[model samples]
Target: MLPEGNEMYRSTYEAKKAFKAMGSGYTKIHACVNNCILYRKEYTDMVACATCGKSRWKVVEQKNKIYNNIPAKCLWYLPIITRFKRLFQSKTTAKDLTWHATERMVDVGVLSHPADSPAWAAINDKYPDFASELRNLRLGISANGVDVNRGNRSHSVWPVLTVIYNLPPWLCMKRKFIMLSLLISGTPGNDIDVLLAPLIDDLQLLFDFGVETYNAYAQEHFKLHVVVLWTINDYPALGTLSGCPYSGFQGCAVCGEDTHCINSLNRISRVMMVIEDFYHMITRSEDKRSKEIIVDELDKLQEELCVTLCLLDKHFPPSVFDVMIHLTVHLTREVKLCGPIFFRWMYPFERYMKVIKGNVRNKNRPEECIAEKNVAEETIEFFSQFLKRVDNVDIPPNNHNNCGIHKGVDSSSITDGTPISAAKLVEVSAELFSKAHFFVLQNTSEVLPYIKRHMEFLEHIHPTKQNAHLEQEHSRERELGACRETITETMRWISHGPNKNIIKYDVYAINGYTFRTKAREGKVYQNSGVSVVATDTHISKEVVTYAKNTYYGVLQEIWVLDYHFKRIPIFMCDWVDNRKGVKRDKFGYTLVELKRLGHKGDPFILASQAQQVFYVTDPLDQKMSIVFKTPPKNYKDTYEDVDEEFSTIVPHNDNILPRVDTLDLQKENDYFRNDCHEGKGQNLSTSLCGE
Candidate 1:
């Protein structure tokens, strides 16, 4: 019965002869087939199997044949051998085909490898068409399969024959049918009826046939067929229903329906419109009050609508998934819009109001607080439901949290209950309006008027309040004064006059207890000149002394002698013994005491070196005298030269006399005139000071 001219048939005979010649003890053979070459080794000696009358051979010569040279009669065997190899290799190598085959095989066992069941054999006998068209069968071979080199064989006849005989006709037929079904069902179209009609009919037929077959073979499995049919039909119904309104409806007036249902429909439509409007309001508008109303309405609608839809799901057996999907998408859009709208319309003002209100009202109203807490909890529950619906639809993770809207609300409440306040909320709302109004302020200067208006509004509400909390405000005012003084002093030094001409320096000296004068036209009299007095409160000497003592090195080192000379005494005053108990003889003329007396008598002396000399009226004599020598022709003597000459004739030995080498009083006067014409603390003074 062996095929004629077959190389394997010839090789089998050759192997037997070789074994017999070598005498009987051979037990096994190793064979390798590669690229039309068959390499074989046979055991030449004989052995007996205890369980049966079979004989084994061992230790014969190795044999090889290049399949290309083998007789043409051997070709018939190649396909059979190749088919068996493909079946073995497909298990590891081809996933798509294997998955398709394996899934089907779970219901119907492997077609190529039959089991011991008579039912399977009878089915095989009835369908004798085992071989598939070569084009339809995809072959795969892998190193993981039996006989790794088998794939190298050009024409494996035995495997091809075995596959042709063993292949199941039912599997191939079922595969073809499924592929055809998928092709017909997957066409694209907006009209669901047209797209799905053919698929539904085919699915129905398949359902009936499958049900019949399962009932005959295994009655219990017929229900699974019905379930599969229902699942496939679900998607089609969804598409059809979604497109119905588009195809069947006309204008509302023409589609005459019952007034009650029609009214309900109109209300639902209005809810949708309001939802959409809220989206635009939060995202696009800048009006705070309008946005607030929209947000509140949106919250109410979300709660009512979502609960309504969930209840509808219980009544209708159709896919609620699509409706939930639409609702969730809308909710997600709202959540995303909440943050920017809140920040623009509500957050800042709310935060400011909360700060202004201080928590005093809430402290005594625990019941009201608890009620508000319940509202917040309800809000969180609404958000949770929205999130759950979104999750069921398998929305991408990136869109899940709507960029942290829920987290933002929760954090704002938990960390600081409603961080937004009324004033800041108004400010932010106004900013948003401004942004919407000009968007690109072409003139740019127009922005100034808007800012001025807003600032004026803030002033009206939080106005300076007469500095009623003056002590608390003092440190801020002091810092501001120091900064103004620095700028004025800088301008004075850069100009040609004494710093007294700088209005800020004069004001500072007057406030610091280092300057004094009778008022004329609300200005301090000094050197035949009028200087503006500082409006800032006088800093206490005791506090100043404490500051100097506490931060001695820091304060002393940075106290600019040319600008802030008043700050220097806070450090030096420790050496001044004005106490009556101290012996006047031991301290000599008491320069420290004299210095303190000078500060007390003429605070204007702190303004400039010239002012100090011009206004040092002795308290005892009631007369003013210059201690240093008179100015040179140009008043350009070096500091050391003037100091040496001035030291030769001391006026009062232990008196705190002015140094002769100090800046020329006339030049300093000229500097102040050039620097302080606008006066200090006025808005125009900033221009004079350059900053």
Candidate 2:
């Protein structure tokens, strides 16, 4: 039999080689199995590891006809210069690189993007040479060891993922955009530092001498400036990445101030360390004196961390510090940069783990399967971006269209102009439709007229036949659409008048869900700066939903159409920015900050409103409260213990008396006496004894 790397497979292999040649090539620097120096340049000829004295090859035989295994681990590097230019290959993604400076921060009331910070501007100021060119690129890096088995089984597959912060929010999460710069794999217990040396070396070179690359966004070439902003990971991953003992005593990454408790890692463990986050500490609305006091303390703590991370302190050593901690303090130097802890946090990566997990088809070789899937998806995505209908292709949904959100392409007819409510009613059933119309019970006289006009306008724009054949086809489409998925909003209806019986009408689900059938009741004034009560949030609990402590907000808009074929009392409420409001027990619902809610778009919510009156004391001292339904919950030791006798599963003999029945005469004589029980003399004797 022939060996696997034979000449017959060369043609196929060459094609793959050609394809990979187009991509960034990696440098495979072989290192000793032990923590020895890399075998490169002059050291490449050495047969044994200089530091560890280990053989360079598994087999001593130098000359071989076919196959041989090298006794060394390889450290790989994907060229930064090649990877940087990849961001601009697509025109859509290329333009998004400038979004940080352009569309991010125009209003003074809001600042959400990192570029809006003083740190970004400071970096620009310090590097006047680089900042002279507005096309300078900034990068954020995150690294973690992903177990190929999706937590089902353990396998070493540490992949370092790097993201470009310059991209917009929509494009940032893409697998194609996220570069797999390095892949670290070894036998059981390999110090990550040994693997990271190559990457660190490259990073240093990239920083010292910026890579010269073409800016496709701009017509000319420029020095592509870059910096490793942060390394994001979970607590345990941080411990591994930072070389900090976060799980043990003196473990908190932020403070590193040990509580010295013997029992931790459970029961109010050290893991939940209270870190008055730098951003939170600075943003709080406090007095000047208080602010100064906080700033003074934070400054001291920051310096302590810096000193500790540098291993300059007498107590600390290089072994205790890792690259993550040293780079973390860099954020403290400039306020514009999100704190080191926050910038490269693992939230996005954690979410992306699901995407990676989904790509795995073969459990035996999950890494290979995921690599193939990721490449295929990225390749398809790259080609799809070049064509039109990018939205459908970019966020490639499931093969089946069962998405809770409407599946139809967004159109002006679905939700176009703001609908005006009618003041009075007028008969319009006769004017708009023939006797064959399906619209029954118009909300009001004026509402009917508006509906009629809207229907006429809709028919003029999207004309449809009233014939039985077309009506059947339309009915079939509506049936399939409704049955396939739950339609939340009526405005986004694909077909007007589902069938012949209820159609020839005007407004579809245009009006929001409401129980009230009358036009007067449907007149919900929803516009900018209108006060309203809202009880809709991601964290809303059944207990809090029952409480009348609904958030007060300015009205955004209220759709007049019925929602989901039911008149639900639903309307959109814009969040009001009020500092004077009292803080109620949210029961875990975090208060939505005005700036965080949305910077440009005024945050609004569509919720079902109820007449839940919350009576309060006035100057006159009046008192009243609305009826509320008690939330259902498990009786978790909250209920009083029942009496011991009744608590048992089987009924107690003392509590339950013996059951008895009245005896009846069976003979035609119709008299029951002791003498009649001759056959059972014991019963007769017992009866006589009783008498």
Candidate 3:
């Protein structure tokens, strides 16, 4: 405040004036209070609305007052062309705007982004001119009602947002990149089309003649064309935007005239296919089939869905056939028409709505509050682009942007350093040290040949012993004494095992996951839970059984064992008892009893082997919790590193749906109640029915 040569404005009026000079202001167009028409175009000079005959200005008492001019309602519209031009004007975003065309990996059966989907290819094939310019934009529109009053009163402010598919998959849906096109106050209902007219007109203009925009990266100007690829919304908003009936007999938009439903008082019928199988086919990001195969599968799924719906009609009442149930028939078609559901869904927009709602400081004028805050943030973010050594304050920096692990080298691994003073060192017992050392050696690629030679020597000596017994023998220190001299220097040190004194940490980071011990977990989000899937072998006298089993545990300590040459991190966890303490619910969620801990003797696992997970307490029982797995923040499911032989960590695929062909639904034998005994009326009713 004391500095005189600063560029900062002194007052809100001065700041607004400077921001306005930058051409980032919202244009306010008055609307009829009755939601009849907007006071624009031919109605610009009118004093009253043409359709409703209502005064455009708000009525006020004039008793020697200033009589400030005010509109009853107004729509804050941010012009689309200027925002698109600003994207290309920035060197950073200008290069990123063409990432889909230049940097995206093109694979036959993998789909990680919207551009990898069939819909993008179809657009390229049909509109060759639009595809000719890699900088041309493909957009997705999303709208939702943001509760402005925070449930204190009945008020909603709807913001129509547009997402650019030109940016990379990681940045396209981020809050800073999403453009807020229009903000309408109150309930628009069916009149949303009227409010969307201005934005639609601009889109049409952009598509017809295109806009001349400067590309900062190319150092030239090009005509930029735009197209709306799809819309993201929930079921109710879907009906509002598409003008489709979301209920009753004509609930489905894709099925059209052939919608299926049942009348009231229905009994039951056999379901044709499993609903879980249908869910598995649509949400898959990896292991996708070819276009021809997908079309054929969609055709089969459509037929199966029709029969399933008819069977559902027989079993359940008409109320059960809501819009969501009916929308399943259209899902396969939507995947064919518009990529995967994850790319074009309302989840990201719903999350962004929280940020939008947080800007409402003034409850009385929420629209104005949001508009001013948005423009301020936008101006700051744009200014950050031209400055050096400055981060865009509006966007949070990714803390989990980890690089890939190179073969046999651990330097590329990232971790938040331990405390300088509290770098506690603890000495574990002989059994604990051996288990941790053996796990690190078993998982490391450099120790594979030495392990193979040791296993072969064990097989030659113990011919009658089972492989499981030999494996257990391999983990012991006495068995490794015979071959310690023949192994390499790294393997020799690993075979001898780490010293009893090792450095211990309360927190450690690996595989893009931040882990904390149970005693150290005091934050809002829990990070103590962990899981790993490994092969379990059972050996009998005549046969052997091998099955992949998942183990869940709570992290108790983080131990980094120093092998002189390299430091290997391992976690000491209290593993939950799999047989009695763990079970899967009907909805496929893993529930574990945290109190029922087991496997105390064998508690250490390599840090690289852990797939980070968190436990949400089950509402039904406080002792139980539902497990939710987490993925890395910047992890993209692409084939960009397909040729790499070994990676420190692999993406978890435990949730991938299994390939299933058919499932049969069983029907009950008796439909009527034969035995009923409650009070005197129940027996009388049973006698009268004579079942």
Candidate 4:
């Protein structure tokens, strides 16, 4: 199919050969049918398994099948040391390998990366020799079984992967840095340890005896060392990997002999204390004194957890107590030893598993298919690094990449959305258009002075008019550019307002968030919850009537206005009525009634001024839902002489805990009272109560 002058591979064999030559190769080790042992070292020459007495060759049918002595199963093992050397061969990656030690912002109270955690510090304290070299690597391993064919539950593949913690937080979790160490096919059962023999041997070697490797960045040969810090997996997989009982009376790995259980329940169970809250409480950006106070109180916190668990064990049924419940006790200790659980978790590994599963083209030979495709991808990625001004095939641009203020830039440069069509266009009504124009002007820093002048003139002309009326007259006058005082070129055009032919969008991405209209909320993910902190001020009788409040709303429409030189995006939202539509639960979660829409007159906000939030439906009331603020992803906030005002969006851990009224808690410790109402109650006087 290729042209006569084209230089391309003619067949799959040629392409495979080129890829193998360019990339680090994988080893195919044979295994017994019953998952007894791997055919390596001592077992290499054996015809059958020594333990299970199972044949290593495939059992073939006499009529049609050929009697080739092919191994029943094979484990694809990728050597780690060669991949490590390859990472150092690239100057960009070599410099990034030491970022944990060199470029990390060492804030004592903050946990941005695993390097900021106490576990990393503990390693440094124990091994001064290893810690002396900044280039040394700390790694985390994770393994999980994924079914290649959804139809067949019996056929599974287990992939052992490792993440290099030496890289910065932004780069470490990325798919490029996560390496596939081993691929075990079929049911390994309890013999997973046997399958992991080769990888473990290499790890043991790297730990005890370092390898001499060339650093392309430093341009010198140096001894490289590594340490496997921890393992990330789910409960059952954790048991499979660690050889610990994840279920039953003695399933609590950390508790050991002190594990609490009840015999009444057929299966072992225990209460899971609120462990997430405890961890989130201490994972804040606090001062040295505050951090010290939290650290010193760890024992006290553990004691409180023990007491809470005891209380739960007494009240809750035996069935409510499971292995997951008992695991909560060890979380605080893990926090102290391993830092925040968010840094080292199975979520990223599970996400990467999907990428691995996508490479499987041939179901008959899934292992070989995955290995070959991964090698090809790695080869392509390596070559792309050297090519200038070319997009990497494997690494796509992040959705949250171009976030924050893009001031003085056109909409086409900053905004990403579908191309506007005449069919999707909706003309803005004069009333709504004026309101949206004034709102954009009110929020603009350059137009603030003009607003103050315009408001003062309105108050002077209509002394007897109410603040609300004067504001309405100001909006009407501004649309016609009829202000008594002269304004700047920017303000004049802004006041004159945008084109009436407004373009509508169902979805739009800006300011590090992807926003969808309420019409599109039928989809799986809801991205329509819009919020903005609005300040309303009225100048009357020298009394500045200022009210600042956060308005929660459902995004109804997205409209972009054309001002000839620039296009500004605005969202028309259905704001919930704060008086009747919104209330705070006992846990301080802002719950809103989506059915009760309000704020009809003022419905527009600048896309940049809005912060994304979501609503989780309350189990007790179907009409109400708890509000959750969405944090910006992959955002770097240096805050060093930045021109735009940087709004510090809440960090990942800060919003994990529900706000509670301490006074109410002190009065009554009804932790699990079914009768207690979550809704806020009105203050009633003693006389009114008596009446």
lDDT by residue for model 2 (42-89), tens: 678887888888766654456543223554465555555565665567
Candidate 1 lDDT (Cα, 0 to 1):
0.25
- Could you tell me how far off, in angstroms, the CA of residue 76 lies in candidate 4 after the best superposition? 1.3
Residue 635, model 3: Cα distance from true site in angstroms = 3.2
Of 2 and 3, which scores higher on TM-score? 3
Off by over 4 Å in 4: 1-6, 33-37, 48-56, 59-69, 149-153, 212-222, 265-307, 387-396, 402-426, 451-496, 538-542, 595-598, 616-625, 633-691
Residue-by-residue lDDT tens digits, candidate 4, 572-677: 9999987799997655578999889887888998887777888999999999988877755434432211112123322223234333346544644355333312
User: Once model 4 is optimally superposed onto the true structure by TM-score, how far is the C-alpha of residue 353 displaced, in angstroms?
Assistant: 3.6
The order of the candidates by lDDT, greatest first, is: 3, 4, 2, 1
TM-score of each: 0.14, 0.49, 0.75, 0.78
Order the candidates by TM-score, highest first — what do you get? Answer: 4, 3, 2, 1
lDDT of 4: 0.71
> How many pairs of residues collide in each model?
58, 23, 1, 2
Off by over 4 Å in 3: 1-6, 21-23, 60-68, 109-111, 150-153, 255-281, 284-307, 386-391, 402-423, 441-501, 520-526, 533-550, 562-567, 576-602, 613-632, 637-691
Summarize candidate 3's per-residue lDDT along 485-557 as a digit string, tens digits. 5667767676667757877777666656677889988868788888887787676655567898889999998
Error of 3 at 394 (Å): 4.7
Identify the leading candidate in terms of lDDT.
Answer: 3
Error of 4 at 574 (Å): 2.3
Backbone clashes in model 3, listed as residue pairs: 268-315
lDDT of 3: 0.72
